[model samples]
Target chain A: MRIVVDLNRCQGYAQCVPLAPEVLKLNGEEALTYNPNPDDAQRLRVLRAAAACPVQAIIVDQLDLKK
Target chain B: MSSPTNGNALKDKGRIVIVGASLTGLRAAEALRKEGFSGHLTIIGDEPHEPYDRPPLSKQVLKGWVPADHTKLPRMLEVHAEWRLGVAATGLDRAKKVVRLADGDEVPFDRVLLATGVRARQWPNPAQAALEGVYTLRTSNDAARLQAALAAGPRRVLIIGAGFIGSEVASVCRELGLQVTVAERASAPLAGALGEVIGAIAAEMQRDAGVDLRIGVSITALEGDASGHVRRARLSDGSTLEVDVVLASLGSIRNIEWLEGAGLAAGFWGVGCDAGCRAFDIHGIVTDHIFVAGDIARSPHVLFEYQFLSMEHWDNAVLGAEVAAHNMVCEEIERRAHLLVPAFWSAQFGVNIKSVGVPSFGDEIVFTQGSRKERRFVAAYGRRGRIVGAVTCNNGKWLEYYGAQIARSGPFPPHPAGFDLPGDMRVVPAEFPARGVPTAAPDVVLTGHDPSERHAEFRPRAR
Candidate 1:
């Protein structure tokens, strides 16, 4: 799976940080920081994080290819 | 990714109707498909537009970072269902299995989900409420209008109540360099939610942010010019402010009037439902088909002494919708319970406020981590020798840990600190003022919106 986070649109709601800590996280300044390429094992959680965002700032695509 | 979830996967089955086509409604529609409920799914909403994100209305939308119209909640999962927008469900015929719409259309369903959320509580005085320059934020249109009004640069803005919405609006006013005053009948801002201890700090934060913080006071009356534009407001202290804008942030009123003759267990506290999200009748008997979710759902929480809690947080809406949808199509044994932990977050004045569990249910608070003096800390709220809730300010990392402890119903002021604590980590009494306390001024009714605020007064009569 591929992960894309819109840093410009991220207002640091930090909802994604908890749901997908392995893929998305917050920096020391509390700004959003995340790994664009997460392991395949983190697919479900990463997608869940994308759905959880109220701002819809996170995008997870390319699910059919698996790994 | 998953292309689109096909509700047809489960084959044609019983009809499932979801009311309130907003966040909860849309999510519930998707969940019905995810849970293999292929029945005829119909969604009815009062709003003309699709479901939009409301959390940004006060923060980013007001700050102009995002246009109110652009805050639409993305439909990540395709919901193949009949969409009936711009119409409200006027009544529910539980016995007949029909939902009456405002347009006189009765949508029949094998099961129905009530997600009719709350509306902004208007000013008591109709004349004062109708005056120009007075506003309330509950919908996207409201945010847009308020945004335009703010952009016009009013000389002074008076926020009548210092609740979350009011305080956030004040923050935006200051961000826009507008002179702002915040009035609260409580001793401090957020005192009703966080109790006087944390509320005092919030009051200081507002004052420090250049807000004219007026505690223990209320607007007696709003005086307007001949053009019917509100220009001034009379205060409880016998003072009048030359304010151009007045925000009636008195909180929200649950939208349940339409269900008046419907005979469902609904009132000011919203619709009563079992843990599985099945609606309860007036006699407290759980219905088999009718379901309830979102900010409108009042369900029992085992964490809080089996008391029915109605939470208005964004997370609650999503979680409740999924659970309700799952239980709607499943049998008794396969049903899922909407046992939400009641978490919420808010950002204002450069501070992030996040909480887990029900803080208002606790009797005392302890600063388990960090220091309040430094304006960053974590406090645990305890009740009956158990940690019922925990709140964090700029300390989000530890919230999940605290949430686990709260879920375990750990001892009040859990020992060992678990991590580093301030030198004086003393457990102090959480001073929750009596509900509906008599204010110093008769004109100002300080509504303590604890989510379950009016439930105590509502349940007895509902029974």
Candidate 2:
């Protein structure tokens, strides 16, 4: 699974920071600073982080095995 | 037209995504489940905590009667669903049927509900906003922090807005035996919502409560200590007040950034939706799968001549959530309309102020029942010779009757029995302040911008 965040729309609400701190973090200015693509093992954390966004800004893409 | 037999098409439970995990989101979730929605349910929120009550934050919580975190809203029923706490939705991909989050993850949903509420508007100047002692009250954490600061016993408290929150803060300050000062950009307190005459009464109430109320004054600059703690505020009227704490209760901004390219009928005013809670796109086309509710939801009112109304009251959140929930899972024919009349209340300065309907929609006001001097009166607001709103000071019992009349589009100066009728029955101009300007209270605004643009403007820009 791969995660792709649109930095332009994130307001750094930090709702995802707590849910998946390893993947999503906030900078000193409190803007959302996150990893674009995490390993497959951290897929659940990525999903949870996406679910926690109030503005629904996060997006997770399932990797296709054939590709 | 046999009722558009699409019930069977929706029988297969679909994924429902609700943005915002506050009062409206929680209640709507419970409503969806209660209405037999077995589809996958996902609730997304920017706050880490579960949905909680916000009304008590300014009153009981701040007064130390209840802890801010403990002011959780009572769950009417259990809503078993995926709890997405702490992440913010950044974009909406309507064609893909997905909601994008900041972490670059997308949640696929057949239907979506935009319950993302509003946030407290901050002071414009970055230097003043960065001052440590200056604060804006909106979230639970904000209330908790401010409550602790107030308990620390600052020398004096200065409030820069006289809206309900600011007024209530002053009332709380009095209860705490602390000296308080209120400065408003408007001509009088509550002039934006209730107009000049009623605003004058409110201004008097604040003065009577010993608040150094200053109207028609704007904060030019906020001076801070060496450590960046606010020390004094310079007013536009060429006066400065030495204060230890400063609170800016300017108003609130809707939380709508996530719907940037989702291309819904969303703007600065809020996401436009029908009375049935279904969201409309920019072109005004209603989509069945998308819905909206709560403080962020803007819909038209039948009683107010089909003018879109946006409300931030607690009652509207509860009522709007229920209606949105019912319409989300049910068929179009079985769906319900969210025509709930707006109502709100505030306990300040030994007065229990309650109001039904949107007073700003009214053009005139009359002292229908009780006297303003006694601080126990019911003022009726009229628009085009019909009662549209009513407010009662320390007299809430008569609100229901007036509310019903407003809901039913009753006559101006509603004549409910048991009140002395004045032979001269005249209505006076409310003299409300112009829209989109600074005032004492939060005006229901339509920001006419995408959620993303709204948030971007608030972001600290590089020099």
User: Against the true structure, what is each candidate's TM-score?
Assistant: 0.84, 0.81
Second chain TM-score for model 2: 0.91
For the second chain, the TM-scores of the candidates in order are 0.92, 0.91
Predicted candidate 2 versus true structure: per-residue lDDT over B1-463, tens digit per residue = 2221244334345788999999889888888877777778899999999877676688767877657776555454567789889999898888888989888889988778899999988888988898998899999899998999899999989998998999989988988988899999899987887888888999998998899999999989999999999999899989999998888998888887667567677766789999998998865778978899999889988888999999887767878988988877676678788887887776677776778888999989888777677777788999988999998776666777888899889998777546754343568898888887323331223444777554211221232
How many clashing pairs per prediction, in order?
0, 39
Off by over 4 Å in 2: A1-67, B1-12, B420-425, B437-463
TM-score of chain B of 1: 0.92
Looking at candidate 2 chain B, the ten consecutive residues that score lowest on lDDT are B454-463
Give the alpha carbon lDDT tens digit for every residue of B1-463 in model 1. 2111223332357788899988799889888888777668899989998776677688777876556776666554667889999998899887788999999999998778899899998887999999999999999899998898899999999998988899889988998899999989988888777788888888888998899999999889999999999999999999989988889999887888788767577867788999999888765778887899988889889989999889998778888999988877665677788877888776667777778898889989988888787767889999988999888887766777888888888898875456768777788988877788323211212245785562221222321
Give the Cα lDDT of each candidate: 0.80, 0.79
Q: CAPRI band of model 2?
A: incorrect
Which DockQ values do the candidates obtain, in the order shown? 0.09, 0.01
